[model samples]
Target: MPTWDNVPKGQMTAAVLTNPGYSADPSDCFTYSTDYPRPTLPSPEWVLCRVHAAGLNRAELRGRTGAAPFIGEFIIFQKEYREEPPKILGEEFVGEVVEAGSASGFTEGEKVTGFLNGGGKAYDGAYAEFSLSHRRRLYRLPATTKLPWNVLAAVPMSMYTAWGALNLAAGLGERRKKDNKPVVVLIHGATSSVGVWGLLVAKDAGATVIATTRNTEKIEKLKAAGADHVVLEDDIDTEVLKIAPDGVDIVVELVGPDHIARCANLCARRGTAVLVGPLNKNWSAGKFEPFYIPPTRNVSFFTMTNSGPGSEDADVDHPTVEALLSDVVHKIETGVYPQEVVVDKTFALRDIGKAHQYCEENRAVGKVVVTVP
Candidate 1:
């Protein structure tokens, strides 16, 4: 590997989750890897970015805790395959462009953040002090934003997924002023990192946001995150009916089939359930057909895979990416969305496995960060 022209040597430190082909138990957390080689730097082939802060997303939990492999043969080889071992995995991140390659706009030490390509599956992700980002896939972190390192990293996977599902795939973001109403957005699993974003976007888009959380304690936090009303998962139906009798115009479902029927019930005519995120680490990651979709109701289900295949797919929708990132940055800057509420906990890179367990327990209010000392 070629040395990054301006970046220093030996600055690498990352929380690495080892993938052992089965469900991870608390005891499995006994060993956590640290300071493993950061992605090496080079010349024309690629440029490496030094990470300042990387947010912990649920997808990272899935990859590390026997959920899925960061880079499986299925993605890289263009063939059928099973899961592979895990390397450093993270879905969303905030970093600085420390080394620019041949073409240049990004300067060394410029603050920036973005999501992992290809859903982060089989993709080497950022969870370290230094990592490589394909210059094409990376972007500026937005000039107006001032998020703490952890919060900046947290935006990509969860929030972008939420934005794409509701607005793009589910056909919600297309609404013009005349069509825009104080519509109701039913957000499932309100305390999930993405769930926090659904609440943020729905409100900013002029919709009334109704969020759901398994733990009652999270309800207050969801409200603080801009949920118009917060309800426990068990009481979803009653809460939505009481608050928005017209029914929900959109449903961001984090909990899957378990809540499918309930999601359909709350939807208004032509409403959609952008149900890509599943809360449990053990389940196959996806957004399946709601247990039922009535012709009369016209409810649609969308997870982000509809875009294309592998890491290269998301780039096809550059405008979508630009809008989502810009919108999020605006909210973050104006305090419409505060990064402080998005972190559940943080651990040093040495405690990588503990971070995995924290995410696997499925009790986090938001992101679980692994920071370097």
Candidate 2:
């Protein structure tokens, strides 16, 4: 157990999702309250963090609209919340540890950022002034770091997903090492946060990147983010072939399953296509045939939340995640990674609905963040 001697109060402000269904108005999804009970340490390995900022993701929108079947079938049951409890919804946060259990491997007042099993029964999410997380899911920020809380919060989930999908799931790093030539990568939905990060990461790894967007206006923006070639969504196949005649070595698919067949067709022989996002909100591939992709090409899926503690599918453990995060921080500090391209906007926690609306409307060029001041 941990002592709460430093805690200012037992209650804290939180944005709770009392309703979990689709609504035209985003504000209808949450019931914000200042008297929401602050969570305590679940065990000695857990720590209580004073949240400074939280990142907004499409997953939360799916959670709100009962579109995330993986979360649970219970999400669609309104009657259950009346009997049980309505959980908070958020996945990534940057905060200071206020109460550290003896076995948590952390001391009080340390700044950390990482993913949480948000909205799950075991632990509440980061939509509160305070949240609880196991030590394994967190990365301690250096005392000398100068990054803002919102920027730090935005990096974890997007960066982790992009890095994991490309390197681990799609084997971009290994492919780069093996191939004497520069590996070619295609990032579909290149304007999304994950797509933006994927473009940066692939460019940083010395890969020739071809990025795609629905709007032609964002083509310049993608190029500015280090894309060697930018193609409109409709012209992706034609334009990509013009750039890489042999097809791309890796495809980071952020547009969802609707484009899986097309993306797979664009892959080079023995290349990999990793689906990392569901931006279209369409879960079904709609008559997608497995035989459409030849045995020579591969299709894979990646979920950033799978790496949280206790997940059997997690390939990279805590220490590896921490090291990657540390490298990202160094890149941000040294201006290698442009901070402006990482976070597009910030909203106060009270205005979370507006933030959600902005993100869902696709107005943000990068990540949308909610600050918990």
Candidate 3:
């Protein structure tokens, strides 16, 4: 329904896939769509940014492969998307604002970073040179001297999801009290991007943190990210129990079905456990009461999803969501949040097939980013 007449002049190169199917590497799914139209402000509150870098998410792979909640059965399909010809598959980006709408609060030349969930939801994506986003979702970035543009691409998606699960789902920030003994938080699968950001956000909230990761090399890095205790994935229960005799106040479970019950059992009475990622192949846990019932604690469970009631766009200026996008950026700017940009690898936009292949291989330690020339 939106028109491109208002879109900027000039052609931009983008990675696109016209057909959909499963492949061993998924590199074959991509085609370099040349002469793409540059994006313009879609609304008065939106701004058009010239994307410098875009990060890949596992959901992109799932969507390409026709997985549920992404592209298969559950996710609704629109006729416009089907008839639109090429499909772009990226959600997060860091760039410079090229044009601002009349009501957009940002300046034209400011650098910004943000997550726009439009690949399968509403708008196109950031794989192209130019992308549009709501002004409230865009956060001003410090000078490239403070943080490079490529590095910030890894922050928006993972950090925002982590912040959302904690603030929106678990209410960790609202419940945190500095005067009292710090709240205890547990992060399962802490080596992943979301898990690592959860650890940092929990620590930034003044909570005592326990993290689980298989990588021995990242133990010290995890500690530096404000984790009070870092233990192996298998040792989570033992190490966490040893530290918090009662149980943890909050649990961010990145590992799925197999570990969900254990994570729930580790929560204290009236505690909260947020299941942000389902890494396990099987999501069904049989019966909830029998397999997952906490022995002593009546804990609450929150499942983080891409589309839901509170799963709206990230508003930096107005943070109804658990820390605003601006809040997390400030944390990184100030010394409260970890400033490390853990990019596993980078690829040119034309070689996006290789980028998706790299992420599908599941060997990358952190985020896989694609650079736009």
Candidate 4:
């Protein structure tokens, strides 16, 4: 068998999702499948990449737990386009292009990073030795990018997500007259991967940012991540009000449904509240009566759905995935964003169980990336 990097031409190693149960065990979730076939170039716009390192996302647990924000619909999509059994599990990856179809606009051997498509099977991700992505979605790294591939691996999904949520929901690039004014902003779940990048984007847009985190240890980290003010979760309301008595102009809510109401209520008149994840173990929000808010002081809610049409554009009220990726890459190239990648830890692909366990526990200060040797 022809091999490159120890992976056979037609076959590769992958962490197959053998059990799709929402159980409390990590080891019981993934199993090594050596005979997993490498994906063929699907179209002229597709590129086959050799995986270098794949970053773990909170969304990665959706399949195992069946508790995603869109798990039901994702399952339906998978059942419709079902292919391989067991399924490949992963999302964002940094890799070297092994085969770029003639129309892909990518060159062989170029280092690139981006996220997997949204439709089809949810598990056709970057957890394998080889994976596929579209040229329109992939971002080629800048020649001046000095970050290691392991660190750069963590940027694509999180950055795109953060940028989308902030720009789309919070109006980062909106053409309002108030756009030039420094608005008071609150970032919930301020230390999570998306939260950190959101903080940076908000700061760059000249908003005065107030960040919230339950972990006191992350306060300094959040500040370092460009948060102007950091508050513990319990102090969110009081502290945020103290900083912006009338309420914040925008709230980047990553903490999910449990605290969304409170965060929304904290928005100033016509202010925006955006949700990026459901990190608090609750995905669904229960119905409740409307809280008394001023007629002028109403808040609008938006969810960060990073897929489907116009998912890549920043219209007045939405963000395009492609635009955000390009912005983040350019910022990294110019050293405007932080050069250091906040990797809490790295795990060999073989030790994936331990990696999943760590992410499950939510003990990491930054991202947990799995490296492919």
Clashes of each: 5, 0, 0, 6
Top TM-score prediction, candidate number: 2
User: Across residues 148-246, which tens digit of lDDT does each residue of candidate 2 receive?
Assistant: 898898798888889988998988778744456799999988888898889889999999899888887777878788889888888887889989888
| Cand. 3 Cα-lDDT | 0.68
Q: What range of 10 consecutive residues in model 4 has the weakest lDDT sum?
A: 311-320
- lDDT by residue for model 3 (235-270), tens: 877888899888888888877755667767888876
Per-candidate TM-score against the hidden true structure: 0.79, 0.88, 0.77, 0.81
How high is the CA lDDT of each candidate model? 0.63, 0.79, 0.68, 0.69
In TM-score terms, candidate 2 sits at 0.88
Q: In terms of TM-score, how similar is model 4 to the real structure? A: 0.81
Model 3 alpha-carbon drift over 4 Å, by segment: 1-9, 40-46, 68-86, 103-107, 118-121, 139-146, 174-181, 214-221, 224-226, 257-259, 281-286, 289-327, 330-338, 341-344
lDDT of 4 by residue, 1-373 (tens): 1111222358888887777665566867788887887877766777899989998877666545543335432321323333232266676688889999899888998878856543224336788888887676566765456667777776776776677677656676672535455877788887777777777777888778898888887788777777889999888878888888777888888877656678678987777777667777566566644564445544445533333554322231213444555567777767677655346688988777678888887776667888986
| Per-residue C-alpha lDDT of model 1 across residues 113-174, encoded as one tens digit per residue | 64554334444567666666655456666675665666666676677767777777666666
The alpha-carbon deviation from the true structure for residue 332 of candidate 4, after best TM-score superposition, in angstroms, is: 3.8
